[model samples]
Target: MKFTRNASANWKGTGMDGKGTINTESKILNDAQLSFKTRFADGVGTNPEELIAAAHSGCFTMQLSFILTEAGFVPENLDTKAKLAFEDGTITTIHLDLEAAVPGLEDTQFQELAQKAKAICPVSKLLNAEITLTATLLS
Candidate 1:
């Protein structure tokens, strides 16, 4: 299977004055010079980490749902959070915290399914960082 999205950025002057745009249609990018914290990059605007978080959370939940359904269970609630941590001017790691409630399934079964999802999710497979999944089953 293959999927792709393209992004582009333009920068000038240095850390403060540079800006860019994100074009979803062109698979290109938006202004990213100021980053998310600054208005130069809109909060709702596009950046690599936020996009990665969205992908990870969405894919993880979907994969978990499918696996649980195949195991004869339905999810009560599923929440996935991804935190991208940077260090030394590089993406050091992406930490995932996932909580799930699957009715009619044992804790062991839920954990197994969650683990499987973590292993097989597309974003998880694409990232080289250490990904962690924390799943909770609530009746």
Candidate 2:
């Protein structure tokens, strides 16, 4: 399947002093503010890295759920936390911490499926950085 998603950003002034607003086609992030301080320091706005983290976590979790379902295991819950490391103006790595409760799924099988999901997720394929995953199977 081929599809397109859209998001736009409008900025003004210099890099450090400039400010921008990000808007998505779905309007989930309508007029969200972004600034240098927001990216570098602790500011009251969202940054690209944070957004990437959110997207990666959501994508990876969904992919895992699909894999689990296909493997005949119904997941009671899946929680993923994606941590992105950015340095030297480049994305260095993304780490995914996943805790899942899947009925009748073995730990080894869960780990294997989680690895497959990390490798095949759309966002993971799009990124040019190292991706790591730590998966915990809960009873």
lDDT of 2 by residue, 1-139 (tens): 8999999999999999999999999999999999999999999989999999999999999999999999999999999999999999999999999999998998988899999999999999999999999999988
Q: Would you estimate the TM-scores of all the predictions?
A: 0.77, 0.98
Error of 1 at 17 (Å): 1.9
The CA lDDT at 30 in model 2 is 95
Off by over 4 Å in 1: 1-15, 26-46
Best by TM-score: 2
For model 2, the superposed segments whose C-alpha errors exceed 4 Å read none
- How many clashing pairs per prediction, in order? 9, 0
lDDT of 2: 0.95
The superposed Cα distance between candidate 2 and the true structure at residue 116, in angstroms, equals 0.3
Cα-based lDDT for every prediction: 0.73, 0.95
Error in Å for residue 21 of model 2: 0.6
Q: Pick out the ten consecutive residues of candidate 2 with the lowest summed lDDT.
A: 102-111
lDDT measured at residue 79 in model 2 versus the true structure, 0 to 100: 97
